[model samples]
Target: GGKNLNDHALVEVLANEAKNGIEWLKTIDANLSQVGSFGGASVKRIHKPVNDEGKTVAVGSYLVPKLTKAAEDKGVQFVMETAATELVVTDGKVTGVKAGDTTYTGKAVILATGGFAANTEMVLKYKPSYEGFVCTNAPGMTGDGIVMATAIGADTVDMEQIQIHPTVSQETSALITEGLRGDGAILVNSEGKRFFDEVGTRDAVSAAEVAQPGGFAWLIVDNKMVEASSVIAGYIKQGLTVEGADVEALAAAMGVDGAALVETMDKWNACVEAGKDEEFGRTSFANKLDEGPYYAIKVAPGVHHTMGGLKINTNTEVLDASGNVIPGLYAAGEVTGGVHGANRLGGNAVADIIVFGRIAGQQAAAYAN
Candidate 1:
């Protein structure tokens, strides 16, 4: 729903900024993913010079493997299932988190528990119209960090600016990663017409796709698109996709008109030849749906992740509104604000967690000493 007309332009600027002089990152972290630029919520924006399909390669080759390895090599002493009851602040400096009767004493406790999108009551209290909206996040995210942070003074930004992914399975409402459509999936309505441009940001593309004739649109792809050879196929193997034999059969099952699908495909094939999308203005498409028994899967919007939280300095230190750094306190990951600004790109969240997690850990641990 949020459109950035300058998204592609910004990406180019950031890319140029990197290619020329990027030593700041090298000084901070060596094992970081070598991104040419940042701030694309989807690959289509980042690789504007390439087709939507190539972005999947960018993620699979560059982002995922690097982040996964970095996280494994630098594993935090994670204490899972432990509730952070309250921030133990003494004389206005956060020292630790108190959970149940036990105390987690540290120089700082990074409250990266994520947002309250999972909590219906909290959503209603803060963002009312978004209530009853089902959340796919862990059900335990009941504004605990927000509440706890508020009790001790923490500022949040863009609380109302929550972005929803469009391609959600209507029944289960699981978030279909935007990467699938990035790798050449078309969205079909009940009429079976290709409805939206699949090359936009995840949230915007999802909204456009599902807003067609169907209350739910099936994300259609070919066997070759999500086959074992496809980078997105790995996710399908991980139980993320629903496939069909052909487009007509897919339409029949999803209550889409088969004839409309044939017509839609004809026009789309024409556009694919022209090398430009007429309706959606997508010049960056990777593959055609020419090879398949086509596929269509259900989709809807579910809360992917929150983009707002405690304010932090560039060094990952939590700071108050008055530009005063909170002593004995640090933050990282999704809890730390301002890296991605209003919205975050797909792989960047993982990047933020890893890069800032190290800063928070080292700083917090050192401060503890």
Candidate 2:
């Protein structure tokens, strides 16, 4: 958590790469169209249009498709629906990858298969306490790259440092992006009390929610708050959110104590009116819950990002247990770790892939040539 603070080398690397990634997106018509600022930092997001109930548009959703099309145009082979089972090592060098019974040989290899958050067995093995927690990862994100690399003796760092996002849908576990709260949303517990600052760090908010009666909380917002942001549309369409004409109605819908909910709203509205959240020290009281047509979303902490993986240098070269580079082997993205030491911020993952991914590509190309 303390590892990737302001001006850290890893932060710089991801920031530099993220800049290039944004620039590259422009070449594919996936330009930077909106900036989402949270916790005093900003992230540039690519333009994507989707209806309610649609998946959150990530940069990879646009960038990777364009990159794949471009790569195909250049005669790059495409392998679909296959799993990497092993690393083909020869004379202390990785020569290729073994996916199933077939081996795809190459002069160099770069592993970008993402983290193992979806792998229940691995999750239990690493963090057993998170056995029943929901995950917001694809089923294929089983840490294949980490397994293949480690099979070849690659060293790893921060394997125990996984991130559980503070705001995720209770049923589906989809990320209710921190931007919602950054723009202005308040969280309340079962007793209908504002327990923690809405805009606090992810770890703090998550801990407070887990300490509550049901290990969950409700994010309350008004029509004005909903109108100001596009995220509510998706949540509403997905049936992940509930709406009410007023606080009493909303509380009844959520099965919370109606009187208690009204009292909490009164206190929260007071904070918004006074422009200070003395009760929870919330600095971002952008909107009050006084308007009709209020909404509430049930949220809980769920596994979101893994901050540990194969160790690498600035060049994106994978290292061994003794701090020596593994020739012909490189890694980037979630497969390679140390970028976010304990917890990853919201936008840093995009930055990490962009920065180190390019380095890994360039370095592997140079070595091959």
Candidate 3:
């Protein structure tokens, strides 16, 4: 579906290796159980993991520890709090990295240092219009790898293609998962009316929210949704949710017109029953939000992913400005671009990392041998 929005060759590579990546996770004890739909995806293609209690776990939370433990079991050294400051190039080929005063020389170097979403100076440097937007990235995402690679003549791509997630808690800068919208949650403006298709692409949804009355919207869900999704339940536990006994009460709590909200709820439920969103042309519907104990969370757009970074080939070898591979230098994950062209689809980031990360490791190992 996002073929026109992504690099075709990279999309094919990711598609070809997606299942193998998931299988590798399963080998490392990742308990992926169900497939679900996400925004922009035409079908149920996103694979998610579950915990021992059969509840859905966030993919990053579930996979990181499992992967770390597997690497530890294989005697991989853990380096913490040290940032690589330079890429050591000897005779026109990267041979090692420099962190602080120490130089760790190796036959190959893989850059997995993530993106620059958290680096405000860098973000504004690329996309200046996002001046005051809060970022959802971890603080460590400062583009160290991009800086180092580029300093040593590695080329980059799509440096200005930064992405903002539509539903983010302004107070905590925490991203609300899109699964809520996919599972039938809806967004209402300060007027307590649905404005846009709730499950639209992130950029479109974010732009719509920006054009709303207060530049923010309330994501509404019900107890039934909470019971169905542990991720939503966790947001409630984090105190990000405002609860109400009914629709009118929820409207009052959110400071919107109670009558308008009640009318909106009635119309939305009718649309759900009719299997069509007559108002907004929404094609996805899970269930009606008719249950009691309705919930609302005030959300706005926040910086999420920087879709541009150092350039790399399908083999994961970093490329120079001339489209020639930089010998012994490999990169994967957010540190490299071209996997996503202009806009990235939901659930593809995990696949991008696992697939290209494995490719970088394999290619680097073969180069070393």
Candidate 3 accuracy as lDDT: 0.90
Task: Please write out the lDDT profile of model 1 over residues 311-337, one tens digit for every residue.
Answer: 776556666667677787777665544
- In order of lDDT, best first, we have 3, 2, 1
**How many residue pairs clash (N, CA or C atoms closer than 3 angstroms) in each of the candidate models, in the order given?**
4, 2, 0
Evaluation by TM-score, superior candidate among 1 and 2 = 2
CA lDDT, every model vs. true structure: 0.60, 0.79, 0.90
Positional deviation of 8 in candidate 2, in angstroms? 4.2
Stronger candidate by TM-score (1 vs 3):
3
lDDT of 3 at 300: 99
What is the per-residue lDDT of model 2 for residues 194-248, given as tens digits with 9 covering 90 to 100?
8988766677788889999989999988887666655676677788888899999
Candidate ranking (TM-score, best to worst): 3, 2, 1
User: Candidate 1, 66: how far from true, in Å?
Assistant: 9.9
Q: What is every candidate's alpha-carbon RMSD to the true fold?
A: 5.7, 3.3, 1.2
Q: What are the per-residue Cα lDDT tens digits for candidate 3 across 246-277?
A: 99999988999999999999999999999998
- Candidate 3 lDDT at 259 equals 98
